[model samples]
Target: MKYKTICLIIFSLILLQGCVAIQSFPTVARAGDTVTLALGSSDQINIADTTVTYTPDGGVAVDLTSNVRSIFKLYPDRASPAWSFSAASGIPVTSGHSASVDIMVLDLPPGLVPGTGVIRVQNNAVYPIFSDIPSDADVAIEIVPGVGSPAAFAYSLFGNATAGNFTSLEAAPHFRIKPDFEPNAWYQAPTYAAAELTISGTLNAAALAATESQVTGQLRIIVDEMPTSLASQKQVSWARNGGDITINYLSPTGKMAYYETTVAVFFAASNYSFTATPNVSIRYFDIDGNVVTGPPVFIKSCTNATGCI
Candidate 1:
């Protein structure tokens, strides 16, 4: 499930201190799509102690060092087309055994214009803080026109086998259907086309409350099957409740689904229903306010009559 069409660009540079490699995932990106730059060193050199910069085509070099951000008056650059490290993500890691940092470039609404750029990393040059120095390396990146809508829909369905255990049905107890457990609870139709679901941005409380009880919770989109902080879960709510529930991604973040990846959608929601079958419809919209991915749908059938639908 690799997005192979967008190749990984690795640029290596040897300096007197040590060599460094800069790798960009999905070398090609859209204007408003978040991109990741993986900087790895031949030896252990904490990227947090160094300086990072991004120079857009024909533009001045933008300082990407998170620590020096205050001195440089830096803001999230990529979102502005000028290019800066993302705010939501932290700087590269630092440790004796690790020599890599995954820099996340968050794209805000109406993000950077379609263009080219180079990301460079080097020493921070501060006194009393001698550390492993990394050589200079430039990773080229190409940003194409923004794809305002999601490209595909991918999701998994979870069902509660015993719905009668609780007074009301919430999303907390639902488990994604897998082969090990009650496999029959999870069913995918032959016509279904699975796509990754990108649930970014802040939660829509008003919209969520209107759909169900004032019940507001958060949703976390697990990518590459990695775990994130529980606090990072942004407020989330279903669009509606019934045997079927719809989750809409038309929030301000305007994130699109990434293609060719495996992702799991995890969330805690308010009470919905007590039906025998629960269906989830995840929808995305294009720039024209039209639905894309045809709204990938997944359904979980409750085996027990009193199970949470």
Candidate 2:
């Protein structure tokens, strides 16, 4: 009876040993998330070939690149540089039969588009027994937009007062003219005396005797005397055959100094009209020769009309 009891006890111990659970440390990680996997010492398990596959929940599986596998082996205690399958490190049992592996995901390059995805990790080993295991993890990425900076305004003048005609009295006076501009940008325009007559060199006979002196010798003048910060009104005038003709002035800044010159010719009547529309074009550009914006600048015959051309 005692011998029978001993046999039964030995059988019970063997059954208990078999029932002991093999602890599995399984983890799921996103493409950019870090993870760690460990096995107990008694398991005598070693990693032979490890790989991670990615897919959307309902999409097809795609193998993780060797670059990604190499990144996973960078952990000092988790991987052996000398032993690898593909890019994966072969985990070895050194002092302890138990071992742990660490994995990490890096940021994707700008070429990758934002998307939703999932990942699975697998381990194939011989010493411990080759097995494929998978765990589900989610991935989320976002794309940002690119924007350009605002451009600056440029200034220039086009008239008979260029460098070539600098010494000639026939040359028109220099006037600072601001182009029509957008908000928060800079501009300049001519300033003239209000209700006052300013004299310059007398008009030549060719100009004085012309049928329309106002149009033939007309000068488009500009000035920079104004503060460029305030809006003010000024008057412009010139003598034709020793008679005063009035022109209109509108500037944002209060007048600091006056700018004036005679048009080469004067019309017989103040109401004399032109065959083509008289208009000035204002163009804005940046330092790099790129056009920024533009607006039409009009000049009306103030001697007759009150509005702009």
Candidate 3:
């Protein structure tokens, strides 16, 4: 009697989870800000080579590159540097692992139509011991339609310098900044990308033309980076052009890296924290030098708040 050969193959994608779960901040995220995909650790799957992708709501798929093996892999419950606020996301892990990624909304690959978006994660087998481990997961993220938010972020203008404390106009607009993540562990370093902020507003061109003559920095933009019990700040120096002032900072690549930081932007006249009247705009940008997110800050003058002096 002769016996025949038999083969059995297991499909991991069919057994794995793609849209595991997403835990993001501010619930509602605007363009230019940062959003997160809360994929648990990698130890659960027995091996670690995973990939990330972004598919805008009503758009195409975008590949997100993350190399864990090169960045230090974490086991179940073994906190990864990028896992900031992971517990809040409720990632699935008992025998499984999860990882979290923080991405600037604008950095996301442009969606086909720009409506709803999804983040997908997949684990591939890199060796024989890790074979048959092809699995995938998905998470949801909503992209709002406009750039400027109605948040409390504001700015103050100071063209008329009074003993270094500029006596200027003020305006506040909506603003939300993506905070930076810190990875205080071995082999953990967050990646950084450039984030540029454009500060602009209507000037009493007439008043400015008369006394101050231009919308220059007397009271410049301010940066606030804080933690629960600790806090720090700095004044942002901007490159000014008539009514537009540009501020730039390189944001960390992800929440995964250690020894990195992030901050928010605000406007002030000189070094003094003075209030402003409405009539200014604030916006955000990408490395491409385009407006990715923000609203025009509105400004009003001490002499006139509307229609140039």
Please name the candidate that would achieve the greatest TM-score relative to the true structure.
1
lDDT of 2 by residue, 234-281 (tens): 333433333223333432233412222112223334343233323333
Q: Which runs of model 3 end up more than 4 angstroms from their true locations?
A: 1-19, 44-48, 66-113, 125-136, 147-309
lDDT, candidate 3, 117-163, per-residue tens = 76665653221112222234456666676563322223344754233
Residue 265 local lDDT, model 2: 27
Worst lDDT window (10 residues) for model 2?
A: 89-98
Q: Model 1: what TM-score?
A: 0.28
Q: How accurate is candidate 3 locally (lDDT)?
A: 0.33
* Whole-model Cα lDDT of every candidate shown, in order: 0.34, 0.29, 0.33
Model 1 gets an lDDT of 0.34
Q: Which is the better candidate, 1 or 3, if ranked by TM-score?
A: 1
TM-score winner, 2 or 3: 3
User: Higher TM-score: candidate 1 or 2?
Assistant: 1
Put the candidates in lDDT order, highest first. 1, 3, 2
Taking the tens digit of each residue's C-alpha lDDT, what string does model 1 give over 226-268?
Answer: 1111111222333333222333322233322221122234444
Give the TM-scores of the predictions, in the order they appear.
0.28, 0.20, 0.26
In candidate 1, residue 295 scores what lDDT?
Answer: 31
